[model samples]
Target: MRTDDVLEVMNELVAFVRVAEAGSFSAAARQHGQTPSAVSRQVARLEKVMGVALLQRSTRQLRLTEAGLDVLERGREMVAAAQATVRVAEGHVGVPRGRVRISAPKAFARQVLQQPLLSFLQRCPEVDLHLMVVDRPVDALREGVDLVIRLTDDPPPGMVARALMPVRQLLLASPAYLSGRPPVRTPEDLMAHSCLSLGEQERDNRWRWVRGGDVVEVAVSGRYTVNHSEMRLAAVEAGLGVGCVPDFVARDALAAGRVVQLLPDWVFDNHYQGTAYLLFAASRHTAPKVRALIDHLVAALGPCAQPV
Candidate 1:
C-alpha cells in the first residue's frame, strides 16, 4: 500500500475506535473536532474496507456487533500505539504542547492540588490542562486522561506509579475541647472521649494508632461520623470530638492553634495512608507534558510529606 493509503486506513480505524469507545458517533465527533456525519462516513468507509458490519445503530443508542467488538478491542491498541508514536516524535522535535488531562478526587484536588496545578500552568506556557474531579478511580485509557493522581498503597496493574508523597493522618482535637478534659496519655485514654470518625469503613469506628513499632486498634464511638475528611476536621474544630485527619488538612489549623495534635507520638492510619501517586501508562513516560507535570508535583508536594 502507498503511504497515503496507510494513513487513510489508520485514520479510519482511529475514528471507528473512538466511536466505539464513546458509544456515540456524535460524542466521538465532538471529541475529535469533526461532524457526526463525517465521523459516520469514516466508520462506513472502514466497514466497507473490512467487508463487515461494525455497528448496529438506532435512534436512541449505538451497539457494537461481534465483528465491531473485535475491531474495537484490537483497534484501541493500534490507536494508542499511534498516539504514542506521535508523542515520541513530538518529544524529540518540539516543546511540550497540547492538553494534558488529569483525573483526581474532587476534595483533594480542590483542597491541596488546585493551587499547585495553577502554578504549573503559569510556568509552562505551552501546556494546557484538563482537570476531571472524580470520586472513584477512573480508567485513564477509556477516559482519555494523561495522568491520574490517586491515594493508594497498591496502584492498579499495568501503570507506572510514581509516589509523590506519603500521606499521614493524625489524631487531633480542638484546643477548646482539650482545655477541660483529662489529658490523653495513651491509647486507652481515648476510650473516655468521644471520637469523630469516618462512617464509610468498619476500620473508621475501629481507630488504629501506631507508636514506636507498636500498633493498636481501638473500638471507639462518636457523636458524629462522616464520610468526608474535611467534615471530620470541622467537627473536631467545633470541639465536638477528637478526629483522625490528614496532616495537610490539619496543618493550617495546627499552625493557627485552632486544633492541637493529640497523642503526638502516635500516628493515625486511614484508608488512604500509604501515598499519593501519579499514575500513567508506561508507554507515555517519554512524553514531555507527562514528565513536566510529574516533575512539578514531585518538586512541590513531595517534600511536604510528614515522615512515616
Candidate 2:
C-alpha cells in the first residue's frame, strides 16, 4: 500500500476496533467525535480493505466477527507503535512549545507541586501545562498525558521514571489528643491509640515503624477513612487520631505544634516510602516541552534526589 493508503487503512482499523470495543457504531462515533454514518463508513472501508467482514451489526446488538477480533488485537499494537513513533519524532526536535499534560495525586498537585510548577511555567512561557489531579494511577499513553507524578516504592514497569525526592513519612498526633496520654516512645505504644487510615488498601490500615535495626508492623484502626492524604492530615490536626503522613504535607503543622510527632525515636520507614517520579514514554525525551518540564522538575526537586 502507498504511505497515505497505509495511514488511511490504519485509521479505519482503529475506528473498527473502537466500534467493536464500544459495542455500537453510534458509541464509537461519539467517542471519535464523528457522525454515526461516518463511523460505519470507516468500519466498512476497513472491512473492504482487509477483504473480510469485521462486524455483525443489528438494531438489537453489535457483535464482532472473528476477523474483527483479530483486527482488534493487532490494531491496538499497531496504534501504540504508531504513537510511539510520533512521540519519538517529537522528542528529537526539542521545540518545547506545546502543551504538556501531567497527572498527579490531588493533594500533592495542590499542596506540593502546584507552586513549584507555577513558578516553572512563569519562567518558561512557551510551554502550557495541563494538570489532571486524581488519586489513582493513570495510563500515560492511553490517557494522552505527557507525564505522571507517582509516589511509589517501586516505579511502574515500562517507563522512564525520574524520582523527585525521598518523602519522609512521619507519625503525628495533635497536642490536644495527647494531653492526657503518656508519651509514645515505641511502636508498641500505638496499640493503645487510634490511627487514621488513608487509601482503600488494607495495608494503609497497618503501620510500619523502624527502630535501630528492627522493623515493626502494627495493625491500626481508626474512626475515619479517607482517600485523600490531605484529609487524613487534617483529621490528625483535629485531634481525631494519630496519622502517618508525608513530612512535606505536615511540615507547617508540625512546625506550628498543631500536630506533634508521635514515637519520635521509632520512624515510619519503607512503608509509604516512595519517591515522586516524573514518568513518561522514553520517546518523549526529545520533545522540547517534555524535556523542559523534566529539567525544571529535576532542578526544583534536586538532581541527586531522583535517578535519571
Candidate 3:
C-alpha cells in the first residue's frame, strides 16, 4: 500500500477503536467531536477493507466479534504509535503549545499540587491542562492522561517515576487538644488518648512507629473516624483528638502552632507512607509540553521534600 493508503486504514482503525471502547457510536462521536454516522461509516469502511464483521450492533449495546477482538489490540497499537508520532512532531516546535492531561490524588492535588499547577500555567500561557484529582491509581495510556502523580515506595513496572517528595505520615494533635489530654510521650502513651484515624482499613486502628532500632505498635480508638486527611486535621485542630496526617497537610499547621506533631522522634508507618512520584510513559517525557510541566513541578517541589 502507498503512504496515503496506510494513513487511511490507520484513520479508520482509530475511529473503530474509539467507537469500540466508548461502547457506542454516539458516545464515541460525543467524545471525539464527530457525527455518529461519520464514526459508523469509518467502522464500516474498516470492516469492508478487512472483509470481516467487526461488531455485532444492537439497539442497546455493541459487542465485538471474534475478528474485532483480534484486530482491537493492533488497532490500539497503531493509534498509540500515531499519537507518539504527533507528540514527537510537536516536540520539534519551539513553543510548548498543547493540552497536557494529568492525574493526582485528591488531598495532595487540592492542598499541595494546585498552586504549582497554576504557577506553571501562568508561566506557559500557551499550554492548557486537564487535571483529574482522584484517589485511585490511573493508567496513563489507557486513561488518556499525559502524566500521573502517584504515592509509592517504588514506581510500577513499565513507567518512569520522577521523585517529587517523600511523603511522611505524622501523628498530630492541636496544642489545645494536647493540653486537655495525657501527653503522648511514647507510642504506648497513645492508648490513653482519643485517636482520630482512617477507619477504611482494619489496620488503620493499629498504628506503628519506629525509632532507631525500637518499634512500637498501638491499637487505639476515637469518637470519630474519617478517611480524609484535611477533615482529620481540622478535627484535631478543633481538639477532637489526635489525628495522623500527611506531613504536607500538617506542616503549615505545625508551623503556625495550630497543631503539634506527636512522637516527633519516631517515624509513623502504615498507609500513605511513600514518596510522591511523578509517573509517565517513557516515550512521553520528550514531548515539550510534558517536559515543561515536569520541570516546572521539579522546581516548585524540590525544596519542600526532605533529603533522601
Which is better, 2 or 3, measured by lDDT? 3
- Give all TM-scores, in the order shown: 0.67, 0.66, 0.69
lDDT of 2 at 166: 74
Model 1 TM-score is 0.67
Candidate 1 per-residue C-alpha lDDT over 1-308 given as tens digits, one digit per residue, 9 for 90 to 100: 35565466888888999999898999999998999999999999988778889999999999999999998998988888888998768754457766789988766787789998999999988889999998787999898898998888888888888777777888899988988898998887899899987777666688777888899878899799887778888999999999887777888888998898878888776665668888888873357777788788878887653212
What is the descending TM-score order? 3, 1, 2
Candidates ranked by lDDT, best first?
Answer: 3, 1, 2
- When 1 and 3 are scored with TM-score, the better candidate is 3
Which model scores highest in TM-score?
A: 3
- For candidate 3, write residues 248-286 as lDDT tens digits: 888889899998888889998775878998888877336
Per-residue lDDT of candidate 2, residues 222-290 (tens digit): 788886667889999898988888878888998888988877677786545577888988773457787
The candidate maximizing lDDT is 3
Query: Candidate 2, overall lDDT?
Result: 0.82
Candidate 3 lDDT for residue 80 = 91
